[model samples]
Target: MKKLFILSLLVLASCSPKELTEQERWEKHAENTEIIRDDFGVPHIYGKTDADAVFGLLYAQAEDDFNRVERNYIWAIGRLAEVEGEKSLYSDLRARLYMTEDEAKENFEKSPEWLQKLCVAFADGLNYYLETHPEVKPKLITHFEPWMTMYFSEGSIGGDIERVSTRKIKDFYEPNNQLAVSQGLIRTSDNEPRGSNGFAIAGSKTKSGNAMLLINPHTSFFFRGEVHMVSEEGLNAYGAVTWGQFFVYQGFNEKTGWMHTSTGTDIIDEFEETIVKDGSKTSYKYGDEIRPMDSIEVSLKYKSGDDFKEKSFMTYRTHHGPITHANGDKWVTTALMWSPVKALEQSFTRTKKSNHKEFYEMMDIRTNSSNNTVYADADGTIAYYHGNFIPKRDVAFDYTKPVDGSNPKTDWQGLHALEDNILVLNPPNGWIQNCNSTPFTSALEYSPKKEEYPAYMHSFPENYRGIHAIPLLTEATDLTLDSLIDLAYDPYLPGAEVLITGLLEAAKVAPVETNVAKEAIELLKKWDFKVSESSVGMTLAQFYINTYYRSGKIPNMVGNKRISRLGRFEYMSKTASPTERLAIFQQSLEQLKEDFGSWKTAWGEFNRYQRNDGEIEQDFDDAKPSIPVGMASSSWGALASFGTRFGKDTKRQYGTSGNSFVAVVEFGDKVKAKSMLAGGQSGDVNSPHFSDQSQRYADKQFKDVAFYREDVLKRAKSTYHPGEKNK
Candidate 1:
């Protein structure tokens, strides 16, 4: 009987199929996945499983912009110096200071089985792309790994770590004795406000009697790619995905949609540690009982001509966090949310949620530390979470600056509960909007009361974009997708209303000498404060405000509170002398004339949109042909923000950021939507899609989003598996 059983076991073992290699397994996943490229070159990926869908999503992203995909991972994984040389050494160091490669791998190992599979797919997809495309050369990361996703779990551009200055890190760690660390915020003329505009309207305000959502992420142009990822395992999501990230950072599934705006809620904190080193061992003072500080040796590599060089540093950390910089004589530890596993899970599971309840439960994960979510669903629900992953701190302690690390009371008790956080659930006003502004004014009368929440719960003062969105939404009636688009691109610059009017009033009080100034004032006097291509008033206003930001003496501070951009306008109106105002105005005109040969250049002629090449950092040439853009900066209260910059030796300002990906969705029996991209889906300059949507973007003409498979097939320009030839 034993011999017969052994013979049967051997027979069963012999019948079992051979184990698959990594390449073979990837090929199998590719077989299960199908990518349909629409006429606009947006990839609509269909897969048999969630992992397969993720695999194809990353593969499609690589096909579109592998340079950006690999570069994102290289920067995230703390190896950018290996490509960019010594200049990026501190950036790599900052990444390692927060989370090392071993720690990232540990995070991947600690993740749940389902999440682990997704991470594996994320790596496999990129690796397979490298394997199939031999012509493509990577700058740093030759091979991808599942653990690399841990470094870039959250999709917010520049993430929380970017707030920690690399200069500060270098001064603290660099061996050079002359290194200087500048403390406090260095105020400068930012290109435009770094944020997004998300508006959710309930059924009461929409024409379809269904909820509506606007996904408008104001990011660096070409920062994200538009995609539609579908899987049989209940993973159908469509929206803008940050390059190389496996999940859609901001998008909607069929039944629900979510938009993320950069949150002002304080998530990163600095703890001033009192160091007490005894011989080689290091310790820190913590309420008299000294606790030993954690120490680790970090090794980093950088490119030196054709060869690579290595540098090592011994890093210190306290219970609070890693010692990032020094304050006076004390080493400061920067504490922030670093839960990679939970953050990745939250980011992925958020797209699969079907209704309000599921979304609310998902929000309970509380790992999204840098964004405030505005939500709408097919179930007639509209909601807003002011900020998630807020830590419960003692109200007695001020957290705006570096706090005493020795004081035990300053330690975070725990995270605030989902219900305890500031939120708006189907407000009576039927609308919710967050332009990276104060949540207390999210829904006017229905908005959350500021006093009801902790001081740390909300920090952002109201901005011009929020100021612009309020009145439009207050009177919004029977809203549709196109109407929402119209509202978002209203062209009225609320920011210009105050600054331009104030300047004109100043001119009325004290007349300026120059004829150009008088002509500019007359042009402004007739202006409706609406930005457009043909409007010369827009050109003058944009140049003038930019000049003021650079040269004006208006203090950024008013009493104890820091003045916002809108507040600066108030100060310029009430404080700046008429002489100073006219002087600044004259400077602006002279500057414009110097650049364009005429101060009266139309906005379109001055403010242009050009895509010269696929380089991450573009070089603008005045000689190149470019299209005129009607959009203005969000600083001027234009909801359709077009943050532009004048390249060296170039007269025209080309947009670099703002309104990278904008979408409006109306949820009902079937989802209805329209979307726009800054340039187009492909990053290769030779690809037709590289500049296909640039004209449409400038014209505010959004194309229909094909969410369903039938619609996708109808618009399909090409179709293929991940590793197959296009058909």
Candidate 2:
């Protein structure tokens, strides 16, 4: 542990440059002709030439945090060793198998003309910045290859993570190991966030009769939103792209807009490879046949600082993928069959698509990464697509765990035809949304059945976010844009009134007899679920939920696998666990009593987004940075949600990370949307814009997203080409 800490320190210390005074000039070849600098410092790059816009965007990103940019690049280039020394060496080795410089060069050659041109233009932008910012030290390869970005894209946020950390392959068996495994499971939630919130109140359901479409997607802060990079030759788009990716990963176009969240559709699998070494030949036997296997040895090298002399190496891999340790007697190497090229092609094509016909045309290309797409258009059509490029496989065995690679049955059959996947359009409910919930509940009674697809698809069942979202949407009527904004800011306690009612009802007697403890229980008993800034009951409830609620099987299965609101109310009605419950009850009572002297305080007060340091307080602080708002109650949401605490005044509190970016696209009319991010655009700490949007984001507000060329220029504050002087 000490060694690990020391290694981290050295890696961080390495960032300090001895020659920090150097400056290089950035040469701009692309045209620069737009203004972009909102109050939040978001760079709205506009250009007569799409390449010019992209060049400026890249340069702007570099200016913010070249370190992260470099880090992303380092991983992409399989050069982790250059930063973290021996510990990261193995990860680099695994990356090398598929993304070597030579391979990237070859792939670049075969790439489509449009993609190739974008790659070159993007690469040149990075190079131009490197030329200008000489003092900013870079380790390993300073220049980036377009394909390197493609390599890092292969990882699963929650998939391979469960296979032990890269450094402690040997520690996979230790009883002491406590690294969080929930992240991987989170990636495989009951419903992966594939579907976006999409539904239209047609003329029949609306009093205005204009027809309303909701294009809401709960996705990663940077994953689903980014500006498009297109040239007059063919590229023209404007919206958000997944951070670190070159293409406009997903966003709105002129005629339509779309958003994506996680869906339950499963596309990745793990296969346990069996190795057999012959006298001089290396091969593996599957069933009755012995096939020659390729051996890939990755020796990673790392140096913390400029002393380049200090380096370490680690090893990982198999013919399938990286060999990861699960525990004693088990070595698992996962095979991920994602079609990145196809996905990218599909993404580029889909953004420019005009309608369902054009959209279906792109669907035939089958370049989808994992996500559920919700689309809305000016044409009064809204659709939900539970789509993924999933490989078909035999379902007799579980694919979530490692399967015997030697078994021919485990091999992936061809992919399922797109039409086989789950999809619903124009349901009677007239509105549909997926806050990472099951597909069955996407609409009224027309939801797709699980029995229709093979088990290998590995999609999620119903999850919590969708659970709460359904009720909220159903409760509202004549929904307008303001109502949607209010829904996004709903601060209801997790499990809301249901769990509280269940707990209250389940209790046999007050867990604590003391006046203070009794008061806390009574406060909870007679309480509302709203998490308004002043509710103290919400604070107590949130803390209790945060402490106890987690991912696991429910004890009682009257109807479902989850604890029902009635069940919660019943349990809490009379405290059951005397000692344990007493301690918790006492603790909760004391904390609330001590802080505000009463439990009646609104949740927003105590559970505030501490606006300390001006803005760092906005993103919530879950123990694990990865699982931002993964509460079981789904108060915040499955894919995105925020947490905040109110100060003494109840208004001066802090807001933390939640849904960072939001977009709603209408197919042909205009993009109606709200977007927020944790930090302002600039990475420069002192810049006001750095954290300017923290309050607005916490306040559930968004600046207008300049999507069209004219809207951006009309609202331009200041813009120029990459490397162009300030004007």
Candidate 3:
């Protein structure tokens, strides 16, 4: 009997599939890749092929900040609830609603051979990092899979998935499943708008007769890492890459530079579905037929003390998409673009394109749904694409509200062609700028005409930054790299100009009786509208705006006015009551005096930049060392935005976002550029790179980029393979 059992075991063992171990595959990949660290700690990865280059890029990213890399994947996949608790379960469900693990695997299997190889390399690179560093333990996801890449294909800070409200999902999927009351559609002002600034200057506007591009992304500090990726197969791109992503999200190659700004295009819409119930069966009305709704069971695990517990939910979906919540009597489903395979292909292939024609060919894929592209190349061409992946719809129905899903007319009619998009090619104005504003104002007189396109194409309003950039770019000629950098960091705040003029006029008509208020108004009247570390006027103006926003004075003055920050400022200047304006200003003075014992505090005393540790969510300390930043927020129309918010248990407002990774590139005979990061490259507190760039960031100083092989070698600080340790 023992001999027979042994024979059966041996047969089972031999019949199992055999393959190389993860370490063995990693060693093979490492042989084809090399990583070089420059003086500023930027990784310049060289590989024999594109897949090999991605392998080195991910490995280098892990070396810099493995915590962020792991955290990004944990949140991207539907596993955040397992680590964070029950409150995050709705967020996990939102991710699962768009794509399931099985669907992701199917997408991976259907990809082309070349892309499949890159996905394999992406997984292998992170798995190898774990094998090499046993000390770093992940919160979840012990083993990375190639299919997991599908969840995070396009590298926007927060993709379209974030637009779906988690609270709505929670209200719909809870145990009671009670219907929520309908709140009238209201577009509230975002506390800190998450957007970017992109500018493309043609050769006709430059001193060197070369097209120049500015890539400034105002994101959460340290959200992305600076990387330089190279391959023997004609792939060399340098820019900021979101952590855990394989592509350089916003960057440029030697021949061309590309910058992406968040667009105002209406790509995602909500549909009102008429749900039908027959006993236990559920159906949704689509056109003339009633189709059965798709139902799936989702099981989620959450941490309770030291043990793990699980919960199960039955989620419903329709042809439009998932039923997230109920609107009045109808179930509302969200519809957005979700093409993981094509998006990944377009993202990776765009890095290899060298000229305008090639870049245009890549745009034909139309998988990028959330951003606008500003392009400049060595061929002396400059172009602007308002939005990629626009879906064609009937002009009669309003897309901003929930459309009837039962109506066949509500269905999307294929995608709009590239020629049909809002595009500007070689504008006579010699420059293009988009600050997440309407493309109709991208170029002064050379901007695209809104009358020619359908109403659903765009609905973005003019912002303070766009108003600030038009005059600067229109008059800009004989521009050099230094002048462009200076222009980008210009300290003047146009939003402040409008509000201060109102305050001065109000003080003249209804002068405040308090001495402090009189002194504050006098100081503001003599100001130049420029922000600096020592500028007391900026400090006073920021407090004044904060007080007005919190005091609800503007709404009282204008009768429930809901508008953009700039629009609010314009109303305050031209229409607001003088008594209300004086009262708001007096409140700002009183609050400032109470907080700091004086209303004459400098901007530097309250606004600062600090990073004390390597934690993903940093804690700021008033007692710790911090650098004073001179820039203000984009809400105030400062192009070099340094936005801030109050920290925990502290009086000083510490900066947590804005001006993260900034670069200026000139596509001349050779690609000459200068770039700066908010902090250094590494996330470890003990590493020298943790806070090396903090002073440079505060001073608005930039370092020259090492693009050529000779330049990189000359500035190389360390070089190694994937498995090697730095000495």
Which lDDT values do the candidates have, in the order given? 0.90, 0.54, 0.87
Name every residue pair that clashes in candidate 3. none
Q: Pick the candidate with the highest lDDT.
A: 1
lDDT of 1 at 213: 96
TM-score between model 2 and native: 0.79
Clashing pairs in 1: none
Best by TM-score: 1
Is 2 or 3 the stronger prediction by lDDT? 3
Q: Order of candidates by lDDT, top first?
A: 1, 3, 2
Error of 1 at 505 (Å): 1.5
Model 2, 567-601: lDDT tens per residue? 54334434334444455546656556665666566
Q: What RMSD value applies to candidate 3? A: 5.2
- The TM-scores of all predictions, comma-separated, are 0.96, 0.79, 0.95
Tens-place lDDT digits, model 1, residues 238-272:
99998999999889989999999999999999999
Please give the distance, in angstroms, between residue 327's alpha carbon in candidate 3 and its true position after superposition. 1.2
